[model samples]
Target: MDPKVLDQAAERAGIIPEYIDAWGQRKVISTETKRQLLNAMAGVADDLALAAALPPVWVVREGESAVLSVALSEPADWVLTEETGRQHAGYLSGGRLALPAGLPAGYHRLALRRELRHWSCQVIIAPPRCYEPAALLAGHKLWGATIQLYTLRSQRNWGVGDFGDLALMIEGTAKNGGAFVGLNPIHALYPALPGWASPYSPSSRRWLNIIYIDVGALDDFQQSSAAQQWWCLPETQGTLSALRDGDLVDYAGVMALKLSGLTLAFRHFITRGPEDPQRRSFEAFVREGGESLRFQSTFDALHRHLTLAGHPTEGWQQWPEPFRQVDSDEVREFRLKHHQDIRFFSYLQWLAARQFDDCFQLSRRLNMPIGLYRDLAVGVSAGGMETWSDRTLYRLEVSVGAPPDRLGPQGQNWSLPPQDPNVLFARAYEPFITMLRANMRHCGALRIDHVMSLLRLWWVPLAGSPQQGAYVRYPVDDLLAVLALESHRQQCMVIGEDLGTVPQEITAKLQAAGIYSYKVLFFERKDPAQYRAPDEYVPQAMATLTTHDLATLRGFWQLEDLRLGNRLHLYADDAIYQRLLADRQKARQALLDALHAWKCVPAKLGKNAERVVMSPILNRGAHRYLALSQSALLGLQPEDWLDMALPVNVPGTTDQYPNWRRKLVREVAEIFDDQGITRLLREVDRLRNKSADGQNSSPRPE
Candidate 1:
């Protein structure tokens, strides 16, 4: 092969020379062979070159032939485009498509119809126009206390907490002199399979999870005949009473009873019919969702088929020839037979949306500047509903993940096939815009899981180790523009999870764009006393003591716990880990000394866990907005929070751990009402009030 051509191919693939040599060395191929290889990768080559050609863009030129490619085993049904205006049916793999010939030379618009799986870019088939400043969506700040919704058990609740629980929690927080109530991601997940639950790994970013719907709390439920006849089962009733007194979330038991009630409620909804207001709203939501409803239905049908057919379902690549590709007629017939199931799926989404809107309304009622802060995951699974449904826009052979960083030694493999960057730009970036719009709906703020992905993604080839990945860039300008536009439309603020090895330049870009970056107290302690002081924390940021993924405050202080982590298969530098251990011990001792100085602890109690733990040196990393997780505030280990042996999410595992399960201990209500926690909360509130009024100012320790 011509070295230069190979070099071009490698560069387009984002492959470094060392890797190329490692993978390709000793392989023999002639110049003719090189030409064929380029042809084979022609579509991909063009996309890579175009994506690398400029920063992420939205405008392409008319009359130019921009090859459209699909990211799947094969192409999709061509007829699918007519129904949805999504071209997912046509190019599941790389192929050239001439841009509609000749158009007015300014910005024109088009839409792709594959719901979340489609991407399109723009073609400028004309002379370059003057640059214009991009507009963005405006969002508000929400500073409030948070308790997981499912953590609360109330008289009205089933076995677990629900939206009503959240409303009550927010009300209580407000009564206690708090402003807001934050919670975990509440995105929709597939409901066909009963307990496949995790709020973060959502089935659809476009909808809410029905699992959170307050079935018994609904007005209709009150009017139901079933309520009049209800004599609860002793065991179930006892469980509910227990939850009503608990302090943490019980996801397993909650899901079981919630699902049972929701199933009944869904039936009731259909049987009773919609009220005038509900009918109008349903019509409106349907109109807005349009083809998204259809695609969702179709995906639901496919999902059911896979479930029934059993595991692996003949990997898309290995399926029978006709059904193997997305565009095949067999797939079209499959959709026809499964149309009802698909429609039910769409109905489920509408139901979830209605409840989600109710939650948002509750937030607004409480005067929260931002309510229902929604979270967006980094990407979807490769062979999941999204990839199967919108096969046209993905690169099935490559996956998205992180490069080697402090979080993971071998980097990380997320297994989510990313959109073809070139196709996204050429098609007007419809997929991204649509997804943003969907997430922004009824949200006070949106938390982007991996904000850095807007700039670039670490692309790993299929079956390749994360260490062998390369950085594939995205059009940051256009991506940010879309985010800004959506945020403005939603009237919500954007909070980027800009933790981890975010490139230094990205923070400035996010700031300039008015997007807030996360600042966790634990990570900020990298320099101990030099970190942002409590008084110096940025108001623009949502300050937190720790995140769900990291060690809670008390967990961080546990020397034995830290050592246990080191012993785990998780990667960490031995030297750095030991140094950190020593530093932590010294800090703990300093805190103990400070407690002695303050006389808050008797000399004997100075060595006590609680007293020694409260010293200034131990509080060295407290920020302006101290977001203490319940677990951290209680000084319980992470396991205590989950009421389990290990953390709910092991950062770098799939099969090794139940990463998204492990519920919290007790109910959300009990957490607030517990005498100890309530007292601490009051003290914290007092400190916060003093800080706000400028009366709590203390000189810098240095």
Candidate 2:
């Protein structure tokens, strides 16, 4: 193979020849890696044909002017169509046409004509920054709690946390003066494959996970006598009791029970009078859902039918040839023949949406500043509906993952196919826009997982190791512009999870776009043995003591995470295990020192870290310490309040450990009912209020 040809293809395909790794080491992409990545991408050689060809799309910052690449032979008449069906015309000069500086911030279209020459392209004008709450802009500081919803224990839930349980948590938080309740990504997971239960790897970001739907909360359940009868059965009650009592979420069992009840509820829905309010509302929802909704519903129905009928049902790729393509005649036939099955799946989505909306409205009614904040997963599962619906938008042979970093020394392949950059440009970012809207709805804030992907992503070829992956550049400037426009339109704030291997330029751009930076207490260390001071934390950030990916505060302090790692055989060698132990010791000491220095922990309470152990005193002190930070937003994990000993997720492990399934040590009601926990929450709110009043949170030196 010619080197120049490969290099040119890589360049045109947006593959970076070299990049700086996390430890400030420069690494170059090898020939074989580039060849593999390029092979997976179609039209790489012709990817940059737009440079001299017709313009794909132009994204302009609000009030910024730029000249389009396509120049006329002479001055031409130009017509502009704004997104709102508004149009304006102008005359161009000297063969070049520049967009007007006064164009509104929205999606638009432009057409240029000079004699017989004519061209048209999409136009996007983005706001200077995303939506920032008035309170935050006025220097108000707020704190809230983040939790893995599935891990939440509720007395009435069918094993795992549901939208009904979420409402209860929201009310509890709001009553305590909390600004918001943050949650894990509740994106739609495979209902047919309930055992494949990682929230980060979802079927579709454009829809909700019906698993979280509260069956009892639905109006249909209220009116359906048959559903109530099924719910009251001895066997049904026994199954629900077992699920509720399990230490880990029984995804398959909970799904089976819910589906049984939901199916009966759907029967009642279809028989409703056309003029019935709920029937009319559901019809409107179906119509508004459009083609994407149809794809999700159809995919779910077909997947369930194939799996239960003992056919190849791994995913669309494994389905019989005739049913593989979403638009195939066989699929259309099946959709019509199984219209009831399709509608059942769609009905589940409608109920989920309604329940989630109710929780958001509950937050608003209680006057929470940000209401419920939603998490957006970085990508979709490879065998999921998103990829099935659009084969052109992704490179199936390569996966989106992270290069070797502190978290995963060998690097991590998420097994999610990377979206093709060229396809995004060709579609004018409608897919990205629509996804943001879906997750942003019924929420005041959205946390984008791996937000740095807006700039670049590590593409690991399926045949290569993650260490052999190369960075593929994205149109960050344009993507961020689109993100800002959507954020403002939805009245939602944006949180960028800039956790690993983030480029410096991306960091600056994120802040410039008014996207909140995520600051984890563990990673915010100055070193393993020391940490940044309280004042050192930036103001435009969401500070937390831990995250779902890491251990709970107590778990971290007790060294349970390291022990678990050892038991799971996660370490590549004894040296790695020893190094992790050493680091944890240093981190624990560092945390104690900071808490004491910041006047959070009592001086007499375990003065020497070597002699100390994790207790309620240490946990409460840590919460107080974090709340006192200068960050505009602070997130507290419920596990810490309850002193849970395990993590919601243990990264880099599958099958060996039960990840994304651990239930909280105590139920939410039990947690908030404890006077100690409620007092801590009240104090946190008071501290935040004190900061809002321009006073230091620390009362005095411990």
Candidate 3:
């Protein structure tokens, strides 16, 4: 192929032909890479709808009129229908039409008429920026704890954390003057395939993970004699005891027990008449959930049915002929025969949703400002219902990943498929919009995982290595506008997890749009010891001591993560292990030096880096230092308070180590009731209040 032709194709497909790596070296994309990527994108790149007479969608900021371009040769008549059904008429003559000024910020419909032909376009009027809570703007610095919901332990919980635990944690934390609680991505994962437990790779982002359902809290558990009898069984009690006592979550065992109890509840729930208040509420939720809900329930039912029937194919892709697609005749026939099974799954969703909302309300009643902040994963797995329900929106032949960088010399392929950018625009971003709306519900704030995705994503051809991937651009301006519009409408704050090798372009854009930047203590550093000072941290950010991806404070200090990594063979060889050891030693010394500089080093155990253990003072001091950060939100973790030394996840190794199964050392009630933990949290609250009282909290570029 001619070089010019290839370059043009790359440009048309939104591929960046060249880029700089994390090491500051300029690397040009290879011809073979371009060929592979172009081939993967061919299905949607040259989409006919993208080149229609008028663009499929138009984005106009509020308080302004945007000119719409069309393909008409003469004057055309136009009608702009507001979201509320009111219409505004206009004329087009200069090959463009200026949309009516002062259009409300929403999704609206516009139609153009020229002679006997008519054209339609979706219009999105966006706000200038995302929502900023009044209290934040009024200078009320706040603090919160982000946790892996499954890791939480409590007296009432059946091994894994449930909605009941969340309510208790929220109420307890709020009583201690904490402002909010954060969670890992709680999106739906496969119940049938219980071992596929990573929250990042979910079955559907729109639904709840039924594993977190507090089945005992449901009315069916109280009303049904069968459920009560099952709960009292010796076998059931034995399984529950083992799960609760173990240091790791057994996803399979937990599901088995929960499902058995939930099934009894569902049986009782179905016995109620449709007109009963509880039945009416469930029906309303089903109606509101619409096709998306039906798709989710149907997928779960079919997957479960096939698994029990000893079907060879677990994923829908391998299902025998007719059951592959979501809307196939065989699937419809299966649904007709299994309507009750689908309804059972739908009942679980309703129960889970109600419990989740109740927790959010608990935060509100306790006067917590940012009650619940949820995480949204970057992409969906290839076999997920998100793709099966609509194949055109995603290109499963290519995977979204990161290009080679220092940490990962071979780069990383996150098995999640990339969405077709052309389809996104041509469909007026309905897929994107629908996802945002669903996540924003029942939360005061939403954290977007790997948020740099709004600008671009590294797309690796499935047949190629991660290093063979090229960058694909997205419509950042339009996406940000849409994000801002939704944030304001939902009255939720947006936090972009802009960590890792981030591009320079998104920093200013995120700040301008009022999206909070995520800053981790380990990464915000000038060197190993010269960490980013508290006063220097960005105010429009959520400053945290650690994240789910990194080592906890205790693990970092004790070098437990390095040892664990070595055991798991996460490092390549002995030489790599030695280098990590050398680096960790320096890091320990640096942290000690920094703590001494902060003047909060505990007297009993903060003497020398080599001799020091992960003592209470050092642990508390780590959080104390972060609490004094100029960042508006200071996030702490429960692991740090209990001084635990293991990580919840190990990035590279899959079966070599149990990645997402670690449980907290203490239950929720015990964590809050402990005097030392309470003192640490109360100190955080004090520091936040002190910052609000004309302290160093001010927005700055990170």
Q: Looking at model 2, how many pairs of residues clash?
A: 0
Task: Check candidate 2 and list the clashing pairs.
Answer: none
Task: Report the alpha-carbon TM-score of model 1 versus the true structure.
Answer: 0.72
lDDT measured at residue 335 in model 3 versus the true structure, 0 to 100: 95
Per-model lDDT: 0.55, 0.88, 0.87
Over 1-702, each residue of candidate 2 has an lDDT whose tens digit, in order, gives 699998988898899999888788999999999999888887744754744324768889987767775544567788989988888899877656677668888889988777887778889999989998887998999988897899888889999999888888998898788999999999999999999899999999999999999998777787899998888899999999999999999999999999998998899889999999998988899999989999999999999999888884556788898988888999999998999999999999999999899999999999998999999998998889999999988899999988888767788899999899878988788889999999999999999999989999999999989999999999999999999999999999999999866788899999999999999998889977788877789999999999998888888989998999899998888999999898888888888988988888888887677789888788888888888888999999888888888888888789988999989888888888889999999999998888768687675443
What lDDT, from 0 to 1, does candidate 3 have?
0.87
lDDT string, candidate 3, 1-702, tens digits: 798988888888899988899999999999999988888877466664357567888988887758877877788889999989999998888887888777889999999888888889999999989998788998888999888999999877888998999998898789889888999999999888888889999989999999999988889988999999988989888999998888999998999889999999999998999789999999999999999999999999888888889873436787677888887899999999999999999998999999999999889898999999999999988877787898888888899999988789999999999898888988999988999999999999999999999999999999999998989999998999999999998889999999888899889999998899999988877887677777779999999988887898988988889999888887889999999989888778777767667665645565578998888878877887788787888778888888988888888878987888999999999998899889889988887787778553323223
Give me the runs in candidate 2 sitting further than 4 Å from their true place.
44-53, 114-117, 699-702
Estimate the TM-score of every prediction: 0.72, 0.97, 0.97
| TM accuracy, model 2 | 0.97
Instruction: Sort every candidate by lDDT, greatest first.
Output: 2, 3, 1
- Which 10 residues in a row give candidate 1 its minimum summed lDDT? 629-638
User: Which lDDT value does model 2 have at 463?
Assistant: 90
